[model samples]
Target chain A: MNKPPTIVIIDYGCGNLFSIQRALTELDVPSTISRNPDEIAKADKIILPGVGAFGKGMENIRRFGLLEVLGAFVASGRPVLGICLGMQLLMRASHEFGYHEGLHWIPGQVTKLRPGQPGEETVKIPHVGWSPVNFNSNNDGLFHRLQNGTYMYFLHSYFVTTENPMCGIATTTYGNNVFCSACCKENIVGVQFHPEISGPSGLRLLQNFVFLK
Target chain B: MKNRRIIARLDIKGPNLVKGIQFDGNRALGLSEDFAYLYYQEGADEMIFYDTVASLYRRNNLIEFVTAVSKHIFVPLTVSGGIRNVEDVQKILRAGADKVAINTAAIANTSLIKISAEAFGSQCVLAGIEAKRKENGDYEAWVDYGREPTGVNVVEWAQRVVDFGAGEILLTSIDREGTGNGYDLELTARVAQSVPVPVIASGGAGRKSHVLDVIHEGRADAVAVASMFHYYYAKPLQRMYSSTNADGLRLGAQIDEGNLEFLNARYGGILERRFDPISVKGLKSFLAGSGIQCRNM
Candidate 1:
């Protein structure tokens, strides 16, 4: 068996890093949390995890000078998984609290997950809880090692709507709306759910990400 | 469409799991970590680690328990009690709690909700509202585990909490809690209807139908229970289930009188057979039987 390459979790100062790190450790895949450009760029795979606002997340990434290395790293065709806000930050823009620019790595616009009339604040926003993720194609990359209809926990109000519709490879429903839950554009992938906190299915998803060539 | 959530709300007193009727009597159930794992395994949608008396004691002590459980349990965990400021929220979240349920402190300092929500996203802050019905047929919000009354109408407070940036409302009725009288469906409906965010109907749930009442009629996004989860088959207040079959869970593989001690030493107490004593698994299957969508099944 070949030794697993060094997996780096990009610590941009905000994320559920501990849980993710603990999950990786349980999978017997020792990983490192790094903000250094060189360490991040040199890793075998990268996991961009964030837990807060898209603008603030982007601000931190730019502040840490990780914005460029991240794009360059994914351009190298190595696997990169963005979780929740991390995935949102991969989009071109977000409508949260005015307008904010994303990494533009994935061609999409981040918007609130709602289904009522426009400006009706009555609809539930942050769609919290566990829901199933249905893939557009057969059990392939990202859905690797997992069966269909497996449930993963989600904790966010906003979702990504890709301009490049082909970018969305997976989908989940909230209310009457079906939006992009996971997007895979070549080596770049983003999931608007927390795999680290999604239990065994999530751990399996992380494991699949680890072995993804 | 999203499925309704079934949350196992475990009360903690200094890192130990305890259960009480209407926030009064404190009886030990088991170690926090053990029951957390057990409940999560038996099909709880989520878990709440509420420090039952964090105010009287002055600080939160379940950080280590949250850390231990989060490492193993993949579902979201909400920590309540003694969280007064953003730093406390940060502390709990850093310790691996996914959300912080603020009650007393949120009443003391309303800005804590906005600040914590801004810092850690609104999704991480749950407005823990303990409400008691008043003489005027209106409900007032209480804090410090129903010790202090805010004199705020439950419906009004629920809306205010959301506007103040609470991602969800954990509405617990003091009147029905631990009584097995079933949740205060009226109270739950009022608050849930008033709030834009998700509302978790809690307290007064003795049977599975009570959960249905709150979720279907009250429009609560989730249901939280304590006593329903503490006992099994109307057992006595001392027997604790440790195995998947609800066998007495061992403390250290210790056997006493040919039976494994179910987490003995002031731990593991069952509630009286007030209502139907069913396991989390039973609750899930019951809900599923009624065509309700639940995880792990």
Candidate 2:
């Protein structure tokens, strides 16, 4: 028999930890919400859930000294997931609330979703509510059990832009074109949408993340 | 030309459906599942379930209820009550609620609105305000199930909610509730004018005309009435439901006249549909833009 995955949700003082913990618990995954580095180090997988400005979130993680621990965990080839602002933190830097440095797990910058050029209806910033997210890669565990064009809820102002297209696993559209919704590179996965609040679709996504081998 | 919306609001007490007067007069009515299906078949565009007892209880029952309802219903559903922080909102939405409404939390933290809105999106984050007319004729914000006053001016607080990223405002009036005297149009208008996002008028709605009046005159994007529809004393119900044959009413009214025409035209089948102003307006706009000639009646 295989043991369930031990998932540690990083409680960086700016996340919806309990709810994410509860969702993981419902999926039968063993998860804990903690700010301590030891608990995160001992886990099979880690989740960074955040819900605030980029600078403040990174500041809290740095203040708590969980940054090195999380970086070490990611380097260990184990699964690490960053949600919402947590995903943004994986980028090189963010322009939100003034410029600030991120974890730089992914090679990119976090920029706002602005309107299109002349004669174009620019998609508004903070694309909210249930929008359809389509997978770009078919060989990943994130999109394994899910069908194409699945609608997931998203609420964010800024998005990550990576030089490497291989990092993007799924993309969703708002006004005109598509933007990266989920990105994966090796054991590290980042999602801009809250799989916890995305209903059954979100639950299935989380379940996929938990059981990813 | 935006689409009209059909919304169903489920008032819950624990696991069962509850109906009462205002915020204090709640009584368990029946299973929420049954009513949910009923409203879905009736052509509700979207559904919202408020856990009136959520703040009172230690745990939120809205998640389980939303899960059950999501299995059977395909429309968008929003759940609210007792959400104190971002974590609470996350749990409800992950459990199958498309949106989470926060009332008391917004009054307490104020920042919770921005956090949830940024993390979840403004559309999924709603700010529900329970207001009562003060002695000076101005509506004041209330908290703790409408028993405590926040001392914030209702209009000012509304602007703040929007600024904080509340995609929509759920405004409920305590004074005119259950009285069916019609909505506090003045208050609703003030709130609608104050916020840039959509405002859902709650509290006092006695007749179908009141719903129309609030949406058209009060400038509310949506209206929520619990007791009027639950108790069955809701007048002009049929007029709003199947009055498609009336001439003076707008083309939007005809589309909502009955579920048959609406379903045959909209849903591709015959289903009993309750007409919501949002959905009706959308249908009208669609027809008008498409050049489909149809009279108001």
Candidate 3:
């Protein structure tokens, strides 16, 4: 059998890099953290883990000169997963602190999660906790190995609403709003929840991502 | 709009977890990591590590413990106590904590809440408020782990934090803590009503009904439990392990080392009935059965 491919974690200087490394180490998957474009270019897979606002995250990414490098990475078609803010940065734009442009890989907009919407109940902002997700059992995606309504840890004040409905692999309901929890289109996958902090089911999801070609 | 959270709060005194009543009479439990690992397996929604004396001692000592548990436990862990500034919050986050709950520092400098939120995001900042009920039937905000009164109204303080940049609130009732009398519903309700963020009700959780009351009546978004969940969990593990960790330090080294044994001998029979050691899975089912809305594992 071929040796398991090594994964490269990009240090954008915003996410929980240590926890992500710990999770991967526990999984026995060899990985390395690098800011060098050359190192990121040579990796088989990339995980963009970020935690913070859309505006600040974009500023840091631009400063590190990773904007163009990351664009080529997604274009290469190797598996790429964006977590939380990392996922939000994949969208077309975000309405966070102010108007901010995203990587635009995923055709969507990032908006603050408020209590009242047209048909939505007044759920609190910054929805924090563990909630069950709605996954299509037949899709065989990152969450395919798990149950249909498996619970995953979620903590966010903003959510991704994709223009193409088919891109959302799994959905979750908060109050009257049924927003996308996990987004997948080809090799690119994004999740609003943190799998690193999510537990066994979360590990299974990461394993599924790891096994992807 | 979101699933109500069932959070397990562990108050630590150095390595071993200590239990106390209203912040007094603290008795040591075993290794903090062991209990944390168990709670995660049992399906806790989230966990809070509140160091009872880290501020008094002028040091944050949970870095090693947080790093140990973050390896396998994949759930949101909120670290409170001795969070003096933004740098302290950053170091704690780097140590594997998902969120930092600020009380003393936030009260001392309200801008700490806003600046931290701007730096990290609303979801990453949690304002922990310790409140005590006054004779006039009003809630007053207390600081220094409820040892000092801030002369600030509980509801007003909660609103101030939200306006300043707190994404969530962890409200603990000083008088009701560890009394098994139930949460201070009125106080929780007032704070929850005033804030746009999620409010976690802490202190005085005796039964599942107490949780329900606070959620529905108090409008709390989450319920935090300690004795109700930790009491039955640690006693058995204490007997099973002699040494607390790889270190040579023997288990049960605290001044009140025999509290667990004494409680077991004197009130073990009714302890389960009083606090009701409901397993994580069982508690979810009980909540669903009671027609209360909660996420199932």
Best prediction by TM-score: 3
Q: What tens-digit string does per-residue lDDT give for candidate 3 at B1-297?
A: 457888999998877777677877776655677778889888888899998988787678888888778778778899999888889888888788888999988888889999988887777789999999999999998887778898988898899999988889999999988777899999999999888888999999888789889888998899999887776675455344434332311244442456545443423344645677667777778888877666565
Give a tens-digit lDDT track for model 1, residues A1-213. Answer: 889879999999878888888889889898999999999989999999988788889889999998889889988999999999989988999999999998988888998876566654233667878788888766387898777777888888789998887888778887766888888888888998899988788889999898888
Lowest lDDT sum, 10 consecutive residues, model 2 chain B, at B267-276
Highest DockQ among the candidates is held by which one? 3
The TM-scores of all predictions, comma-separated, are 0.91, 0.64, 0.92
- Candidate 3 chain A minimal-lDDT segment of 10 residues: A136-145
Error of model 3, residue B33, in angstroms: 1.7
Query: 2 or 3, which is superior by TM-score?
Result: 3
lDDT of 1 by residue, B1-297 (tens): 767788999888754566678888666554567678887677787899998888777688888888888877878899999998888999999898889999888888999999998888788899999999999999999889878888788888788888889999998999988888899988998888777788998898888798878877888889998777766512443444434244333232322322324333223333334666778888878877887777763
User: What is candidate 2's lDDT per residue for A110-171, written digit by digit as tens?
Assistant: 88876466687444345544566778879458877677877565667778877699888888
Flag regions of model 3 displaced more than 4 Å.
A117-120, B235-273
- DockQ scores of the candidates: 0.63, 0.06, 0.72
Rank order (by lDDT, best first): 3, 1, 2
lDDT of 1 at A100: 96
Which TM-score value belongs to model 3? 0.92
What is the number of residue pairs that collide in model 2? 17
